[model samples]
Target chain A: MIFKIAWRNIWRSKLRSFTVMGSVIIGVWSLSFMLAFFAGFIEAYVSSAIENDLSHIQLHHPDFKKDKEVQYRLKDIEAIEKQVTSLDAVKAYTVRSLNNGMLATATGSRGVQIRGVLPEKEAAITNLDQKITTGVYFDATQKRNPILVSKRLAEKLNLSLKSKVVLTFQQANGALTSAAFKIIGLYQTGNAIFENLNVYIRQEDLSRLMGETAMIHELALLLNKKDAIEATQHYLSQHNDSTQVLVENYQQISPDVNLYESQMSVATYIMIVIIMLALIFGIINTMLMAVLERTRELGMLMAVGMNRSKVFLMIILETILLGVIAAPIGLVLGFLTNAYFGSYGIDLSSYSEGMEKFGLSDVVYTHMQTADYLLIMIAVAITAILGALYPAFKAIRLKPVEAIRKI
Target chain B: MKEVIKVQAIKKTYNAESIPVHALRGVDLSIQQGEFTALVGPSGSGKTTLLNIIGGLDAATEGSVLIDQQNISQLTDSQLIDFRKEHIGFVFQAYNLIPVLTAKENVEFVMLLQGKSQAERDARVKDLLGAVGLSEQIDRRPNQLSGGQQQRVAVARALASKPKFVLADEPTANLDSKSTADLLDIMAKLNREENITFLFSTHDQRVIDRAQRIVTLEDGAIISDEQNAIGS
Candidate 1:
């Protein structure tokens, strides 16, 4: 009977009911789109940062991180590889000597961070070879002094394939050294900053050039599970001793990506609050009008022995039912919106540059969240119930005889 | 005869600007079960005020109303609602029916408040609609029905809960003479056939002529209390 009465009461004033629901739908739609896009943008940043900038984790000689010199290499290279590979969690690790070297071309010359890498292992950590826009990757076992540079670096050097580039750096024995390499390939992963600064060379050739045998500065490890990145790092940090360890992650090495994630979280919460506020006012106004329109009916209910509390609760239940019906629809709309945007990403280039000023990537994408949808459902339901309070109180506390008389 | 309503020195006052406006000045009255009583006077004559005080809708300033031996004034808000729900029914002049409810649903409203079962609600609501001669208009909303039909629905609603007493305050004020007489006749039949008490506060001449018992008030006090008709 309460349900039947409440159902009829909703339709008693169609315009008012429609207004309330319309506001909710709009609020849900707006928040869904905003939060989803922000989520997408942040996820894109984290994945891209991890894939290109940092793998799961990187291991360095404790002092090597400070000075970044080949002389600070760990004593046993093969043993560290064996232990890390046996962990079951470790997918692959690339041993590389990463330090500054001077490169000279016919067009120009500049100092750059020259990375010495094994071709196969290096490919998994950095996608630079895969991003080759011209020529090809250097062969790992070919015993050739060939190197790959970014398109931005190539542009700076004004050089093409087969261009002989000279790289010079101090050796582990404190000896000045230089190596001439044939320019094998040029790559561009769309990041102009990285493309302009980095050069890749053969690991064996650079090891001989550094005057060190079977030694590298750091090992960058890649793992399959992303959530286990910290755990993997922790495992290595705990297992390894004797050699000082420097554990670096993209999260710390590049804090911008993490900052982006944090900002998106705050934005998502703000959107929820804004949307809920709109729903709050809408629902409150709706129930107020409902009580006014149904004054005589409520009084009649009270006169018939329905107490004030029951009157209040019944109305709250009505609004809760209203929210319950609308919640799934709102959630589906949000989920579908995220799915749609996830498949076909929005072109935010024009918007991106402006947003980049504030350190936010403008590539608007959908970051779908299961928990967020649930929270939205619970929030909307709460808002609807809260909105019913005033009217419910009025209905139960009214002087039945006088209220009916007024009607 | 058992007394359905016993108003013992019931005084009602309205607080306006914190000063009391005496609405019912020491009202003392009694109506027996199965009796039709008329409280007749002009506007502000304390007729409706005295009726409200007895219906447990408003608390008396001083005194008590014992309906079916229950002191209505002393009951808490919830207790008063329960008391009214089980023992009293009411009819108003305009908008007597819930606008959203059909004629049957409006009658069912009272029965629902009485916690009647579905089967009981359905059977009794149908019978009440027939009793009010609105069987065909049971499914129609109040706006779709004529004033006469709506008033009949209101009367059916009041009687649906099967209360010991009913307070009708200007129930026919908005009705034409035909509808007014129809409503009066239905009340009269329900009073006689069901052995329920019917009390009306009205200034309508038609209502006055039909009442077997009449009580007249001047200002906030009753000036005459008499039974003009001998027919029971």
Candidate 2:
């Protein structure tokens, strides 16, 4: 019966009730969309970093990370490659002979990290073949000493497809060697920083030029499932000698990615709290007006044997019912909005140049976990209850004798 | 006959700290069961104040009120609410039926507070609304009913808990003469049939004419208490 009275009381002022509900609906919908958009933004950034620069895990000669000397090559390259192939979690793996060197074109010269990679293996892991916009992959060219340079780097060095560039670097024997290589492919990964710093050439050409037959400086692995990364890293770490081979996950390789990933949860909670705080004030204002306007009726209720607790409960119930009725509608609307944007994606091509500097993709697909949706609903319920407290307290504070006499 | 209410020299002063205005000054009164009594006075004569004191709606500054042998002045605020719920019913001049509820629900409201079962509440609501001659308007909300009909609903709601007595303050003030007469006829029939005691604070001669006993006050003190042969 208390519930019935409360329900009817809310409808007594239909406009007021709708106004409060409308605010709640808008708050929930906007909050959900904002969270999903941010999640998509972060997802694009982290995934781009992984795909372009850091695979799920990387293995290097322990000293090669601190100093990029060609002498600090893998101790047992064949054994590591065998172990990598045996793991069911490994989707693709590439061995690279990395050298920090200078690439000189006739027009200009720039510092670059020359990555010696097996074309088919590297393509399988990074999908480098699909990213080629103007030139074909290495398999299509019959030229010797073929190279792949990022479109950004090619432009910076005033070189294009079929252009010859000279790469000068240190050999295993401490001799500085320079080789002329022809660029067979130009690719754009939408990561301006990575594109500007690194260039890829065949492992055979790099090894032969470095005065060694098989010089493996880095081994990168991509996993079928991200959840398998930790276990695979642990398994490789257990099998290998830690002193010789340093096995590191993507997060350990790039601390900035880790920071962004860790801060995602905190950022989501902060956004929700900020939005709910605004909604709490709105709900409190509306409920206070409702309570104040019904002063005489509330007094009559108290005089007719309705206790303070029941009166308090009635007001609380009314406030909560408003949220409960509006939250699901907002959730559905938010879901539909997200689903629509997730399918088509939100185009940010106009900001692509600025976004690429931060390693984020231009088109972002909205994404949120099911758990986050549930958490948002719980947040709104708590906001409504918190919003009801002051008004409910004011209601229970009324002196029945005086309230009854109030006009 | 059993004495249903006993007021012992009750005094009520408004704003005692700054400019003391005495609404009730050491007034004492008693009424037995089944008595149709009116506390009559002009403005500022303490009739409503005395009725409020008797109804446990206001506390006296210096005296105690015993209703059916329980000293209500000693009860806590929460206990007083429970006490009033069980023992007192009130009808105000403006007809304070809950506006959101239908006429039948307003009468059933008190019984709901009493934790009465649905069957019990339904039976009593039917009987009481019928007793008030509002059986046909049971489904209508207070706003849908006439002023007279709303007052009748308030009367039915007041008697829903079967209180020791009903306190009515100017119940006929907003009603037409025909509505007032119809309301008085209903109260008189209830008084005669069920022996329910009634106490009223009023300035209307029609109510004074219908009361078996009239207590008139002047300057916060009672000047006369008389029994009328016409009402008896």
Predictions in order: chain A TM-score: 0.85, 0.97
Model 2 agreement with the true structure over A272-367: per-residue lDDT tens digits? 999999999999999999999888888888887888899999999999999999999899989999999889999999999999998999999999
- What value does the lDDT take at residue B70 in candidate 2? 88
Collision pairs in model 1: A40-A367, A62-A244, A308-A396
Clash list (residue pairs), candidate 2: none
Per-residue CA lDDT of model 1 for B112-168, tens digit only, reads 877789999999988888988998999999999989889888888888888887888
Task: Tell the DockQ for candidate 1.
Answer: 0.69
Q: Report per-candidate DockQ.
A: 0.69, 0.76
TM-score of chain B of each: 0.95, 0.98
State, as a TM-score between 0 and 1, how close model 2 is to the true structure.
0.97
Show model 2 residue runs off by greater than 4 Å.
none
Per-residue lDDT tens digits of candidate 1, residues A330-384?
Answer: 6678788788888888778887645444434456668777887777777787788
